[model samples]
Target: MDKKKISILNLAWILILTASLSFSGCRTDMQEASKTEEIFGTIVSVKAYGENAEEAVFAALEKAKELEKIFSLTISDSEINYVNQNAFKDAVKVSDEMFYLVCRADYFSRLSGGAFDYTIERLIDLWGIGNDWARVPKISEIEPLVGLHDYKNIVIDSQNHEIKFKTDTAMLNFGAIAKGYIADEMKSEILKHGVKSALLNLGGNVLAIGKKPDGSLWKIGIANPFNPSSNIAFVEVADCSVVTSGNYEKYFEEDGVRYHHILNPETGFPSKSGLAGTTVISPVSADCDALSTATFILGVEKSVKLIESLDGVEAIFISENGDITYTSGISKYHFKELN
Candidate 1:
């Protein structure tokens, strides 16, 4: 991918960069370095504060780019494409990282009862939402792909680190959760260089490490699904990841109907779960990223119940009418909705 400006219609989280750096007590003498690049199909930027900030941020971004080569669906030689092409004929051996992430994605698939299916790639291909040739498919075409969300059909061999598909037609897509894992890995890479404080914006998945140079929480604005250029709310957080998912970001319109990219594996269409957007907050970006997409498909009530059951995971759901609902863990002290 090529580095470009973040389009309002494509990102659901906006880092209030200037506001975050404006804390009164921030240390003025700390060294800082930042860089932005296009990777994982989104604008990824990293900023770090420390003596090694420059080297660390660059290394972290390089790590992200390297990971993308192994995971991206569109990359012709990626492990994902190799599996999709040949896993049905034989168990495909993969790297340890690939196996682990596949397992994590499988766990989320089971937890959401298939709402977070990674095997929904067939449907994603059919819709082709972000592609130039995107279109609405007939019910007949969508029917066969719906059952592909049966994630159990994806067989994993722990001993051999292989991935196999019981069904010939099934394909895997990690568009929802891979970025989170990548973000976490990038943070680890930064820490390895002795950087204590940093901020990352991978697409719209914002992860704050430690705190701002001023010892204040990072400010992240939740994009308004109805108005992508503005924020409906903002959160102050430290050492956490804030990820948002919505039907607004990627979509195609036909005959006055807008079809978004968050396809419901059950329906093989854009989710009609009555939620316009969902934002997940957690210390792990992978969980936040996975939960954001899954909960958006689960709708408000089920999402609320499910989030409450999980430890350290909180969610904010925005209704189709622009009303907001959140989990018990969220309070005005750290999270606030704008008028």
Candidate 2:
């Protein structure tokens, strides 16, 4: 062979090798790190993708623990406990995080017209819901607790970072929104660590950060209200949170009646609005969490109206008759019904 032909052949082979290497480097196949731990009375799973995935997942888990300490009502020395214990006596100073959460809780309470209230601890304790000794309280026992769950009585001073209660009977419980709050905070932490794609599943409250490694949306399943173990539908989402509030999650059956943990602040009993479950999808997990509960309590028509007025929020409501209704915004996404 001639020298010119040999040189040209060698150069072409080198170019092909270099191009292959460059293309492989830009491929979407990335490493994923996942961890699951029990936090906030539920299992929280964090999955991160990228070089710092492991570190990001662990950092998110730590953040969840830190927030749990601040929001847990039963924790002895927790910030919420201090506020609850000092109710009616004097204003109790709280951390900035606690104060901010309380403000958000109050806002949602007013937004739902007392449908989703944080100051329902008195009623919660009366019903013993989510407790080891959960039982069905008598009507006489529950009568006095009515009107005591008012969120208006609870005061929040953002300037001093303090919280006060008009009546000592006023107690705060963040069960409906705490997980969502933690998920948001974890997402922030993960992003700070340069993890672009992740999934935070705080029990049933799922938040998808960015798209999948392949750049596709995340598919989240909506649990079947009638069959707790199965899913009724799937919601494809990205960069958003999906949360559901259902009557079948925690409950005790007595005298052929099923009593769920989601109690109405007004009735001081399980809310019965013909809805078996309600799911909210939004950019903010905390907002989704609060709205899910409120929607379940408000029923289908009112919930749809409330979601339609809000921007960047969507909902799926499952009625007791197994009918499913979704907001207009959700029409953009694909929904696959399993049942």
Candidate 3:
């Protein structure tokens, strides 16, 4: 063939090949892979979607179970509870998971100005507030045990990944922050397994790791502190976490006074703030959980200011009578559904 004819033939074949490859690529899309699966339980649950979802959910569930063991104060065999129970007498060595949780708790202790403390495990046990739902401890009964509470004395050996409570009486409780930690861990597990889109809910604490296959943000409902059946606001978020702590979730009323969890560390009493619920949004669920619980105790003006000072935290407080307040940063994300 002539040189001109040869060049023309080569150009035609290249165009045809490009068209065929594009068509083939379209046929095998991200949608063709298996969608994820879902598993639900008391303390932890996960819902995964889009290609390989079943295996993804299964893997997520196993991770959730592992975290549940790590976070559970009820599991006497668990490292966390063991650390709490034995801290007051001798230095108790902790597993890597327990060490991570303790470090987070230590960080939050400084963050809350000591108002939010997990070392009050003795008080929690005396009051029997969480899980077993302890009744109020006699003032005398709790005051002495309070000596067992010591966060500063506790030491974490980060190099070896072991922890020791300086005193045997010292106790640690992850109740105020563990759910968020687990949510964070679960998301990490899913992401490691190539899960691009998943939603993790650990006892109402919600996290959206990525966007849906259709390119829409996940809609997460913020539960009404007063109404458990439906949420008060729906937040559209992706790659973020929203955690809510309420005065009403687990509490028994006595006479005219309402005694709920989220106790005040100073008085060993439930916070007197008129706020009933507080929700925090941040990049990590652990910080979000701690801030939400601590903000509820801090009340309106202080809570608002505290949120403002943080780099990437925003909070909302709902007054007992139904008034809604939120930081300027998150006003757009909050919706008032009280009619």
User: What is candidate 1's lDDT per residue for 1-339, written digit by digit as tens?
Assistant: 333445552443344554556653375568899999999889999999987999999899999999999899889999889989999999999988799899999999999999899888888999999898899999999988885656899899999999999997688889999999999999999999989899999999999999888888899999999998899999999899999999989998999999999999988889999999999999999999999999999999999999999998888999999889999998732999997
The residue pairs that clash in candidate 2, if any, are none
Where does candidate 3 have its weakest 10-residue lDDT segment?
32-41
Per-candidate TM-scores read 0.90, 0.90, 0.82
- Give RMSD (Å) of candidate 3 vs. truth: 8.2
lDDT of every model, 2 decimals:
0.91, 0.90, 0.76
lDDT for each residue of candidate 2 in 220-298, tens digit (9 for 90 to 100): 9999999978999998999999999999899988889889999888788899999999999999999999999999988
lDDT, candidate 3, 174-266, per-residue tens:
788887887788788888878788887877788888987677887778888888677887677788899998987777665666678788776
Q: Which candidate is the best by lDDT?
A: 1
Q: Which residue window of length 10 is worst by lDDT in model 2?
A: 330-339
Off by over 4 Å in 2: 1-29
Ranking by lDDT: 1, 2, 3
